[model samples]
Target: MTRSAPRSQAAELELPGLVRDRVREGRAKAAATRARRHAEAEIAEESPVARVLVDVPLAHLDRPFDYAVPVAMAADARPGVRVKVRFAGQDVDGFLLARTTQTTHQGRLQPLRRVVSAEPVLSPKIADLAAEVAERYAGTRADVLRLAVPPRHATTEKEPSPPAGPAEPWTVSVAASAWAGHDPAEAYLHHLADGGSPRAVWQAAAGSVWPLLLAHAVAATAASGRGALVVVPDGKDVARLDAALRQVLGEGRHVALTADAGPARRYRDFLAVSRGAVKVAVGTRAAAFAPVHDLGLVALWDDGDDALAEPRAPYPHAREVLLLRAEREGAAALVGGFARTVEADHLVRAGWAHQIRPTRALARERLTVAIAGASDFDLERDPFARVSRVPREAHETIRAGVATGPVLLQTPRRGYAAALACETCRAPARCGACRGPLHLTGATTPPECGWCGRVEEAWTCAACGGRGLRAPVLGDARTAEELGRIFPGVPVVTSSGERVRASVPDRPAIVVATPGAEPVAERGYAAVLLLDTWLLLGRPDLRTDEEALRRWSNAVGLVRPGGRALAVGDPALPALQALLRWDQPGFARREAEARAEAHLPPASRLATITGEAGAVDDALTLLALPAGGEVLGPVPHEGGRDSEEWRAVVRAPRAHATALSSALGELQRVRSARKLDPVRVQVDPPSL
Candidate 1:
């Protein structure tokens, strides 16, 4: 699984209907009450409100512990304030989610030493959501809150300057006059500012440069006298969105919320949002909590990306955050993306938002194709069935495309050299010291395994007597090497990460890139050799087909009309037919139906129970009931002799997920009474 990097910043807050009349009355009454109580004792106010900070270290036991509220700073101790409180005799940070006349304290309570900041960090909504996330993920509230609210950025402070970024163009799906029809994206922008009440989601396609789309929407919403929040996938997306927002919304009117900003800068942005200095909030995942006076709409881009899922404790996702906030605050939510998730599709199916999309037929006019597969079409098929290698038919396409422009080779892995096998034996050579797969570093050097730091000497081929080896599972380097050899006179540029080509203009050269790393051709690629299509299409996971289609669509989108795109695969499959006809939307609809029939994700919520084989069995046996559905897998682990973990899956209606989750939490609590917590609950996991 792709573990996404943390965003620059994000936060959660729940604002009560705090009004002017209430603040004044509450303050005056609190002040008078404090004065009367202080007259007699310096020891302690017998029943003073102690703003206790508690974290749910354990999911079922997510209750706040008792703490003392010192008298000197009573007025400043508002809910959402972080303070140093002594818990278990050690000072720990806690957010005051709420205050009450009492706490269930049998032991003596410790007084809060100092309020961390006068500014409020925890919103009541976020605080509640933090607890909710804990319950759902079977994790401690404290753990969830730690990720939801990092310690340092929670404080109120100002910074000298904002961070800088590289000049990478945002990913955008340029459409024709779908804009001539009033440009819902642009109109949505206008309504954001004219808001009397808040709520709405601006649905869009994948690769639509949503940061820019959202910035426009926010600026429009702000212009209409409402605040808007734009949440995207990562820091890179944040930069593009932030820049676009500043350009359109104007600098002073907007604030960027991301973890990448320095502590002081983040605090400043938070304060600006809290104080309503910024009407348009543009940020990464954490920016969902836009502290605006009156929210207009909450826009989340690429809602499907795992980056939207919080990684800390509770593992709450941004889509849920946006949903809850939108529901509670009446803010419009626009969960836009280039590619639609089944969850997103469900939202449209449920009438949450009208499903939006780019016209593929129109898109196809600009798209061209050249497909080769395992049929009469294939000239030279791979022995191992890897598509990325240079097959003879691929050679023909490349030669033709190269004469006009560059040829692109897309592979799965990125490396100089990926696989190594004994030349004589053909079996994967291993280091005797560590049992790890060995790599051949140099002709004279010993083979080493990366896993155990183990090296092997006199390590001859197991199958044959050959001491040397060859790369079996080909990588970008191998492809580049072969391409270099085939077209020796041509300049071969390899793109992977930071040094990748910004744009792939029309050029007579071979560009080799790993998936997701392929740059757009400046003019256009003469041909795209989609190698290893089967490896991508045939993954064991349910998403294999959907994911493979996405890869194909993205590549096709970059191809110029009448340009060549040869996808080498089992042409007999319908996926190939769909590609031949450019029928992505049709294919997606069909795949969704199949998944629904199979009771898979997007159709039913999935709760995966994984642990040691024995532990999983015991836990599954204990889960007697799931409110909305049936239990699915206590299935065996696939691949490898040492794969000891087994899994049990629970599939329930999307509506029943919470109740089922709650039941699991309750079961966990009951089990805790009998034994330690055994099963873990992960909701809407990226994959099973």
Candidate 2:
């Protein structure tokens, strides 16, 4: 019995060791199996080294990495093809940028896991453009590539590309008369038809058929056997441009690429452009990267529209993208809008592009403009012109015009009483809970804080302790209600925000719309009322005057020839004067000069860094200011998502813009490498 007990105790002691040995043996076998499989995986004999752009958004890891291409993926692993690869011991998606005979990488390279698809979805030109855009915006290439390339859909990728349409010969005669109004317009078309790159900032005349004109330009380029890209501000513009393109270039010559088209449709349209099925691509901002085969012309409409500025990281402006594309591909550029922007004027002033606009005499004949309180006679006649939101002259104009055609009333805000003030003291009302501006969502609903959505059950004036509230700023809904009451039995329609209408009937009616939401009238409005001019011009923004003029001009452009546009502002205001005289270019020049003197954008380069206080401080510490550069504030900013964040502004001469961007980019890279929180770096932000 003693001997048996000793044997059992020895067996128990050996059990754990035997189990460990079995597990070690299994691991060794698995390792051997993996090694054998890796060794057996054949590498491509020719051009075995593949440079891949992994889909890592880390700024520090933005560059391409070397990977050995497996023999099985040789045919499929072409440049611009999507592939799965082992990156940092994890499977990741990447684009095969190029293949080389050998790589400079000295370490043992990992082979690609598999090719995502054999299709070369990303074009070399687009890849280059994306990289350039990233560098210019101080963003990672992966971020820009995400914008350039649509997400892959296996079904759509498997589908065959649409057959290319037969080429159509184009000539200047096709659109010569269409361009006769503006001097050199015919010349621009001829240059496009002749395959010459001419850069022009075109100021579209009032009531001008701009869609058709742009379509003519695209057709001219297409006739030259080169492609054209046109980017507008919104989906409504896309629809108009699409119709115009069909009218001029016929069907199947172009495809519209917009996020609204759904993923499958958007991807299909992108594939069509990449496969050379279509030569013309028109859409919103995302279409700026459309890979047109042999690009010839790149045009953008309404470059100042906020929609053209991407809201995502890096926040690239479509105008800059088109400009970059034109410079890179030697493509003609046309920056056309109802009103000229300072940036557009800079293009002309820099001799990079010429201005195409009608003579002052022609412009005056095309547009009839008036300003409330412009002259002593107007003020004396109305007696309340300066104090009234809708003056006697404006009301009379609307009353008379409604008999002829539609009348457009453009409001700067969209909701019902967008701002409230104390009636006794004229001080803006604020919520006690959050100190946010209180606004009425409707006539019956109580006022609520815009920022925190806290209901102000009983709000009192902070200054003067007034109990009554008065709407100092009226939105489209309130304006519409007032207009409806003023003009009884006259059909009134409101368009703004998410419920914006594309067009209104030509019949007699009153259309109250916010800026950028005005609906097109078939024959054009007989009269347009630019209401609440102070709302746009009074904003605490650097581009207040410019943006006000833009919105006013857009509304005025919807009026028919000889139609009246009455703006409710001091006639002497520069923006109003520009509209009154139909001289946007002159206004743009003067504004640009003023900005230049102030060392603002176009004349200088500016960047805004906003984030948490510590993050911002870290970025500032890392920032290497260029020569002649200045840093403006570390001010408390409420613009960031986090309430505790701050903002800093960096400024430099225009010549050192690239240097500033590079410095900011390096700061981001360092922060990323150190695993620090990121700060938003925006070059030439739309607003200050």
Candidate 3:
């Protein structure tokens, strides 16, 4: 049998084991190739782990999330880039906060879906500021980021910054002149130049000189090789500051960042500042967070204007933001206005900031003020002629004052009739459909509901059955019309809202404008008529008197040194006296003292919680307030019809403010985690 088996039989017997070995070798090689491919892909992904802040905008999800960077997106997905990521189960947009080799998140991370742009729209400074702002305002960082950074313009971001221009040093003489008697302001400038962070509140005169003073401050900061940020209330302030900065700091040292300059242009200017191409940044409220490098000084013009308050969830005021920036960056702070705010006064009272003022005699010599209705003047004869909107004294003053320059008339409203009431019963006219108050936008436009925006042709008063309407608040247009008739052949111009003029010719024209819309005359206005003092002072707002004083002071600032201003209001009012005497510091001191006594803001901290009645009540109950804090309301919200929403206020001592903020933040987190209905929480709100 062995002989028959031969060589062929022996080879067949060894074939199974050899074939098995060959199959094992092939399988091993395939496994090795798969491992190598995986290692290569992971090296591409894991090397660049991006910490992205997804734009989910939830309080619970406020922090940055980690994402693995894909191979193709490694270059574009660098820090601060806008990118799209897979959050949860869907794609979401986010800002790439940073890149790191590791993440604390233990779970497997999702990869970035795609890169939106390589342009690092957000700088580290900006991201930090936004986060600080969000914390201070009790808001989600995502919301604050939305306000700090404008929408990304692909075309604009790719474009290069304009070439460098001639370098002309800004003059400091304006600063010296404006701060001549106000030693604190001068010292503030010196401190900035010496690279010291000095915080101050300057009660600068309202007119042309204030802009010059601000420009001087900026120039001083620039002298120290540092940057400056100037935030105002509106575009007009931007233009005014721009002109003054150019005059004092020379051309091309600063860029005006305003929304009025289309998005593309605004983003371009922003990029310039971010890239250190420019040193000075000037713009409206949002510009407080401008990406300025080595910021030396942060200044705000008319910080009390409502325009400075962000109209979004977790509202923040420009003044507070600047204050925060000053603290965070160790930069000098300058908060100046014609009239001082209680908050600013508090800073001086606390010794956190010093007040800069002109000598009483110097201030008196700079501007003259008179009370129109203070004296025993005939309502229908001497000061106020029948059917005439302008008082006779105002008319006379304008007649003589126009010889020197322009005369400014400041009105409270800016249409044919702002508010209407029944002629018989003095009941407000409202729309029949919505029961909203009616207003007249123009002489041609019928009475329209201010809330619902519907024409009330057949409207009837609820309190009175009468239909004849009378103007409760006479507007600028009507005032101009009546003035035009009174002063025949004299040119009358109106400025308000969209039609605001930046500057007026230094001629003998009668300029009528709404608050904050007054045009700067080449030479100061000859006379300023502060009309409708009652209308402004009679508002139910806490800052009514303060705001009125501010408006009056602003108008007074427009007048030449020897020129006069006539205010048509009760002279006995402390605010009116403050304006008449050019006593901003005294007013602020008194205001701060009074607010302290009343346990109001600037002395104490306040937070507002608003939402559906049940939600707000539930949230209030859940709050574990600090020892000195008090919760005051479950009251119906103002300006709502059949509103289910209610508001509750939390008042705390300034010392305990931090604790209160922390408690509120925790409450927000709990609610968010529990998936409960959201409540709107506003700390230091504009109106509240």
Candidate 4:
């Protein structure tokens, strides 16, 4: 029995061992195959050292690293092309910056994993600009590149870009009449047309003809066989500018690059610009980095709009990017807006850019502005003029204007009742569950928590223990509802948030809109009513007054030449006076002087460092401040989810800005090296 063991049982016992042996052999063969291929790959002899900028966001690894390029990838591994390289034992995406014969790296260099694309998306100009922006903002280069270049779409990349062609003669003549009162503007266009770079800060007159004015400048630049780029605030402005460009320059001469165009279209437009297939690029914030060939002019509208600021690490402003490009590329620059910003005024005062503004008489003829509470008649007619959101004078103006054409009512907020307070005690109503402010979405809707989105069926005032609620502030929805009742039989249109209307028919209608969401009228608005002016002026930010005046001027600038604008605010306020006199440049000059005297920004550089308490402490400890640099806080920061988070502000004079940014960047590198928690470093944040 022992000699004749069961044959079936013996075969089954050997199956497990046989399977294990086969798997081991297969793995070993695969490993050997990879090793043999790596050893056999040929390295390029000439310019073998390829400098690659890895996509890692860590501050410590921000600079380009040298890697050996294999012969197979040498042709496709051109500068500005995308590639993958071994970085810290992991294959990471990178941009090939350059190639050289020598090597600064003493250790053996690793070969590139593979070439991602042969198409050169990152232009040398854009690469340098990204580096400058990162250094200026105290951010890692990779972070800036993320904003500079859109993600690659393989399908779009595979499509061949149209061949570069001769510049087309503009179809429509430059509308020189649009700049009739602006002598400097006319001269600026002529200079651009003659291949001269001139920087100017243009103050647009009241009307919707600004697009045409910009088109004239862009066309003037294109006539010199140079490219132009225009950055606006949002997609609406993009559409308007795109239409104007086509009308002036003809079809296929320009492209609109925007996030709203979908990733594929955006990437396709970007490639078209990079390949010199289009000479002009117009879009929102990201258009600041459009790789226009032979860049000649960089212009931006409404630079003060919050939408122009990048809401990411580094937080570069579109205006700053254009300024940088204009300086680096020897290109003309135009910072144009209906209302001037202190930064733009600073450029004029510094003699870096000239101001192009209409004469006082011209401005007054084009616009008619008044403050609701300024006149004695207003106070007499409505005793509640000081407290009423819509004073009697504004109401009357709206009523009379609606009879002629569309009337635009600009509100500060967007919801029905953005904030609610107890009627009896005047205490703000809050949700018991979240302690968040209560608001109403509609007249019949119950109160709900703004932060948590929880309906508060039984909300109470914490300060006064009252259940009753009243809206201290009215939003666009509520204003539209009230206007409907006031002007019976008149159609009421509302525009705000995601439901914003681009344009309204030139008819007898009342259009209520939030700031930045006002619709363009076909024949221009007959009247512009800026309601609740105090809400804008009451913000706690440092730019409150400047921003408030900017908003009011933008609204008032929409009125027809003989039309009127009435704002509900104190007449004595500087912002209101500026609106009445149509003197944004004067107001901006005063604001710049005030900020310089107070050592606040535009006169100085400010960097905000925010993170967890311990992380902030660590950064501050590692920071080596430049001479005259100062730190403001380690105050509790409300930006993060953790209550223990803190914020510190580092400030320096304009002369020492670079040094301060360098020091902050070094400290960030140290934190990264130590593997500490990440902290945000934002230089010149739009708000402080």
Judging by TM-score against the true structure, name the best candidate: 4
Candidate order by decreasing TM-score: 4, 2, 3, 1
Candidate 4, 1-688: lDDT as tens digits: 4586598656646679888677678889999999767653778887998999999989889999999988878888899999999999899999999989988899888998888999988999999999999888888889988988899999999898775444446522345666777746777887898899999999988874788789889989888889999999999999989888777777778899999999999999999998888878999998999999999999999999999999988889999999999999999999999999999999999999998988777787887887876553456654444544576787799889989999999989998998888887877787888788888999999999999999988776778777888888888899889889989999999999999899999999999999888898988999998888878988889999999989888887888877888887778899899888888999999999999998888999999999888889888889999999999988888655457779999899999989988888888888888999888999999998
- Ranked by lDDT, the better of candidates 3 and 4 is 4
Model 4, global lDDT: 0.87
What is the C-alpha local distance difference test score of each model? 0.64, 0.88, 0.82, 0.87
- Cα lDDT tens digits, model 3, 1-688, are 3455667556656679888677678889999988755643563544668899999867889899888876767777777789998887899889999988898888877777788988887998789988877877788888988888888888998888873356565445656776676656666877877778888888875444788788888888888889999999988788889998888777777899888899999889988887788879999999998988899999998878999999987688899989988988889989998889888888887899988877766776777888877453465443322222556777788888777788999998888788888877877787888888788877777799888889877766678688788786788998888788877877899999789888899888899999888998888888999887888877887787888888888878888777888887777889989888888778878888888898888788889999998899889988999989999987888857578888999989999887787788778878888888889999987775
Query: Judged by lDDT relative to the true structure, which candidate is superior, 2 or 3?
Result: 2
lDDT-better candidate, 1 vs 4: 4
Assess candidate 3 and give its TM-score to the true structure: 0.88
RMSD of each: 13.4, 6.1, 7.3, 5.3
lDDT of 1 by residue, 313-429 (tens): 445788877777777678777876545566666676677765444455544444455566555333354354443355678888888888988788787656654557766566877
Task: Assess the local accuracy of residue 265 in candidate 1 as a C-alpha lDDT between 0 and 100.
Answer: 77
Q: What C-alpha lDDT, on a 0 to 100 scale, does residue 560 get in candidate 3?
A: 75
Top model by lDDT, which number? 2
Clashes of each: 50, 0, 2, 0
